[model samples]
Target chain A: MRFTRYLAFLNKPYLLLLGYIFLSVVLMNFSDTASLQGVRWALLQVLNVVDSFKTEFTYRKNLEAENERLKKENFYLHITNQRMREMVLENARLRELLNLKTEHSYDFIAARVIAESSEKGINSRVLNVGEQGGVRENMAVVNAEGLVGKIIGVSAHQSIVQVLTDLNCRVGARLEKSREKGIVGWGGDPWLDLEYIPKNIRVEPGELVITSGLSEIYPEGLKIGVVTDFSETDYDMFMSVRVKPAVNFNALEEVFVIKTEIPENIARE
Target chain B: MNKSHLRYLLVFLAALLVQSTIVKYMEIVHWRPDLLLIILVMYAVQYGRKLGSTAGFLVGVSSDLISGGLLGLGALSKTITGFIAGGVSRLFQERSQFIFTLFLGGLIHDLIYFYINTLGKEVAWRVIWFVHIIPNLFYTAIVGMVIYYFAGRWLKADD
Candidate 1:
């Protein structure tokens, strides 16, 4: 009987809801902005402690956010490390060019190859120097490897170089051993042809070629190329000499513009 | 406290926690099933008028306070719904009848709530009755039926 009485609390009930309903109506009279700010504050303070339990419940979510932050930081670190490596390489390249500049005491402006063209008979190069950098039409362009080209067109910020590979380009070149002058030109071939060297001249396959100073553009003694081969026929007066250019234009990057001015006497000629 | 009291307390707290935390993930057309209402009505059906009404008052006031809503709206409506559901529980035996009472409790709860909420304003009561109240009751009923199916015997244990 006592157990059934203990269970009877679940069975029978009363009109206890009316008292609460009355309290609800009273609270409604003082809702939002009237008289419960202190109660709200106290309740929120209680909730703040209660919120600690909620944080533990959502701990995995916080971990996910932390993971995302760390991943982004790692990616940023990788990009910054890559930039540091590139700067180091650029510093080494600039140092080597500095040594090349110190070896020659001429007034030369360092420039970089910005672009290259590969049209069949009209191969040319572009330099990141222009009239704004005091680059003129006939100034010689060279590098540590030797001559690159000459500035053919000058804009405000860029200059077009007619390189030695162009068929229309001609360089007055001299053999280092014999000191014989010839006009060097390309005819859609990988090697430059040095014309007007007599067949009687003693030329070897491995002779050095230098600028003849016969033109106002390129300065004298600037190394141009090496004689790779030479041949002659009984009927031909000139030896068909083949010279390989010193500058490997395919791998060219940094260069210098030798400030050779056109002489007033030869400017009209 | 006894196991029953601890059970009721944990269930109430869990209902409030789920409703506040993740119920929005299950929302349909910006309307979510009132999980708290379903649990409240289930409590009333198991316990009877006196205890049911008291539970309703405590839970409703907690919801009101926790939600930063008008201080008394949930308390008032929930108190009445608990009383009526407890009263009707004596007359109903089947699960289907309890489902109908869930619908009735939700309707009474919302009607009294909106009626009190828009007491002074010139509001469209019929529109609210059709739009918010009907859909919410339907959703609550569907969820209530499923909960009662799984946990009804446990809810009425020793009663």
Candidate 2:
């Protein structure tokens, strides 16, 4: 009788909340359960349907203006493509003469952005492509402007991309002018920080930064960002350089996944 | 179940839908408002601490599951926020002060969530507070005002 009275006195809502918390903690510890992933995939599919309807309504209203813009973009791209083809042939001949291997060829798979991280500090996005579309984990994603992110998680019809601005994201980068290699990472700000370059090397503002091909994920010579600021601390041997990313992350609508098979040797690296 | 309970359920579902679809597109300076947090706070203020905390935990869990994030972190942070918001509600009586309550609630929620999420990480507290917490607080508060206005009318009609 005393135990029953004590139970009644305690707030039921609080008890229920505690129970929920306990359950969540247990589920989180075993988060890799296939059932959990299936539920997430199902929810994403339903949400995607709603997202598509909304996008269609908005696109229909701007169809005429978008068509004109696309036409202009297509004309410019055609000219650029011809020049790129010529350069590729010349580069291939040069590589053969140097006895260098041409192993960096990649096919592109286009995907649409479905949803982005809802939390304020987290930087991630969901794409409408998945294993079915040839998107796999660790595949680098890019847009017309530049690199966007890499695939972190994938289901049957959707995948998650850890955008460049995310805290965990890091890329091997090089200064376009000086060719000094460094590790670039998000500094919990809009700008990226380039680290590990010796202070002796002169890095100036407005210098272009690009992928150094050191990272197996990103291709060499892809534009990363432009140097916006540079400084050095007396205690540290490395100069602190800030880079403003080439891609406008806030307005990302579509991206292409680079589908390249990692050779055994490169994969080991 | 009671009619009020059913009403809260609908509000929760609607908030979740809006958050995933519309709110995802409404980013400002890489920060977005927390719509579900606003709903949790409003319900907490209208009802009491116990119910508010319970709602918060549920909302956070649902969000974590849907977004594919670390699960317990959201539940832990939001549960605390709900309890605090319920206590804070006692100090205010004016309908106009609802926005202020929501803002305070949002601020508290973000701070707790940020702390919980970045515990082991080497992120500077100043950056997390300024760059993320502050913007989210103000945006959530603004959105909360709009939601409270419509919610108030809905509640009046139900009565």
Q: Which candidate should be chosen as best, given DockQ against the real structure?
A: 2
Where is model 2 more than 4 Å wrong at Cα?
A1-21, A262-269, B155-158
Model 1, A131: alpha-carbon shift in Å? 65
For residues A1-269, write the lDDT of model 1, one tens digit per residue: 99987766544454356578788988777765423745544444443454456556766668989899999999999999999999978877897888743233468988865444311233455566777898877788999988777876555556667788664578998999999999887633346778899988999988988989878888878887889988899998998888998887666667999876667664333
Worst 10 residues of 2 chain A by lDDT: A260-269
Show pairs that collide, candidate 2. none
**RMSD in angstroms, all models?**
33.9, 3.1
Docking class of 2: medium
Judge candidate 2 at residue A180 and give its lDDT.
98
A159-192 per-residue lDDT for model 2 (tens digits):
8888888877889999999999998887766878
Task: Please report, as a residue range, the 10-residue window in candidate 1 chain A with the lowest summed lDDT.
Answer: A114-123
CAPRI-style quality class for the chain A–B interface of candidate 1: incorrect
Q: What TM-score do all the candidates reach, one by one?
A: 0.46, 0.89
In model 2 chain B, which range of ten residues has the least summed lDDT?
B150-159
For all the predictions, what are the DockQ values?
Answer: 0.15, 0.53
lDDT tens digits, residue span B12-97, model 1: 88777666445545656534678778888888877777877887788887777545446677888888888888788777766466
TM-score of chain A of 2: 0.86
